[model samples]
Target: MLQYLTVPVTAFAQNCSIVWCDQTMDAAIIDPGGDLDRLLVEVKRLHLNLQAIWLTHAHIDHAGGTAELAERLQLPIIGPHPGDQFWIDGLAQQSQMFGFPHADPFTPTRWLQDGDSVQIGQSTLAVRHCPGHTPGHVVFHSAEAQRAFVGDVLFAGGIGRTDFPQGNHQQLLDSIKERLWPMGDATVFIPGHGPESTFGHERRFNPYVGTP
Candidate 1:
């Protein structure tokens, strides 16, 4: 079975998740934005063998700690698609702009795309290229767990701000309706910030994209 724990990190309060397979205790840290010491404490507490780092996008709040974390752990970095290469390259600038700790840019060990799958021990998560908030954003869905880790794409009652470089409002809406809605309304999603919400609840109550 797949298990996870969400820990809010950095001033952005980004929801960094620790997902693992219960059988083997093999785990992956998703979106280690910052506060590395805190994240590692939880990993040690859980006694999980950390294997890799998975990224949803390259925003400073979502990927700031990726480079250092990967280097320290000797772990493979994966995903967020190739479109976020520019964002990854600008980590230092982003950190300065946001008053965050200096973030070093990194190259993913493996770039992901739609239809790809990532594994942790015995569990598998399907990857979806959900761009709009960022040209290379992606989401991870675990059919077995009925959960989706959607970074800054959709919220409980709001949506991602498409005002950054290369952002497109219509494209974001399209990605939500086309890429996310198909995951099934019952699927609970872990967003980049705030509390989690079910797709069904968001579809019915989310003012930005809810049905009338």
Candidate 2:
């Protein structure tokens, strides 16, 4: 069985998910935005052994606490795509620009790619490269679980902004229509923020998807 725990962190309130295989207790941290101590606490409480840290993008609100957490957990950070390398490298500057404490640039131990599988305990998460929110933004999907974690790409009622650095409005739209919309209406959508929704709900009501 697989277990999920959502911890909203940082000023942006990004949802940091801890997903693990129940039997092996092997875990992976998804977008440890901030509050490293709290995340560590949860890890201890769950008695989970940290295996890897995955990032959906390199935004400060999503990867801000990565360096600190990785250092403490003694685990390698894994990025599914390389397009976000600029953002990852400029983390400190981005933090400073936002008036937040600077976050050190974290080097990823491995890069995640489209159609790749990231193992978490017994199951694997399928990577879908959904850019526009960030050049390398990705959504992780588990077919067996029928759940997907979309990091700031699409939300319940809206979609991510394309005004940020390297954000391409057209590409983002294409990504949604081609990559996400085909996931089936029954897929569960676990966004980076706000409440969860189903693909069916978003397809029917989300303004970004038009009045389908």
Candidate 3:
């Protein structure tokens, strides 16, 4: 079975997920934005065989701790789309600007693209390049689990902000309605911040992108 736990990290309260394959006990930390101590505790408590670190995007709140964690564990880092390289390059600046702990910039072992797939032990996740919150944002979906980690793309009753340099309102909406909605109304998603929500609930109530 596949299971996951969401840990809210950083002052921004980003939801960092620790996903694992129950049968193999192999795990991957998704979006280790911060709170390294707490995250490590969970890993130890669960007796998970920590594998790689997966990212949704390079925003400081979602990726501030990637380099440090990956280096300390000698684990590889994967994801966010390659287009978000500029954000990765600005980690330090972003941290300082946001009053977060200093963040180091590092390259991902593999840059994800739409239609890409990643693994956590025996579990596989389908990756979709859903850029809008950032130019290279991506969503990870575990088909067997019917779950997705959507980094700042869609909130419970709202959508990603499009005021950033590379943001586009239309692109964000399109990604949700076209790419995400098709995932099925039963699909549950974990956002970078806020409470989790199913596609069906958001499709009906989200004013920004909901169907009338």
- Name the weakest run of 10 consecutive residues (lDDT summed) in model 2: 203-212
Candidate 1 collision pairs: none
What candidate 1 gets wrong by more than 4 Å, as runs, is none
Candidate 2, TM-score vs. the true structure?
A: 0.96
Judge candidate 2 at residue 92 and give its lDDT.
92
Question: Per-residue CA lDDT of candidate 1, range 1-212, in tens?
Answer: 89999999999999999999999999999999999999999999999999999999999999999999999999999988999999999999999999999999999999999999999999999999988999999999999999999999998899999999988888889899998989998999999999999998988889988884
Q: For residues 125-186, write the lDDT of model 3, one tens digit per residue.
A: 99999988898999999878999999899999998898987998889999998889989999
TM-score between model 3 and native: 0.98
- Which residue runs does candidate 2 get wrong by more than 4 Å? none
- Those runs of model 3 whose alpha carbons end farther than 4 Å from true positions after fitting are none
Q: Which has the higher lDDT value, candidate number 1 or candidate number 2?
A: 1
User: lDDT of candidate 1 vs native?
Assistant: 0.95
lDDT of 1 at 98: 96
Indicate the residue-level lDDT of 183 in model 1.
96
**lDDT scores in order:** 0.95, 0.87, 0.93
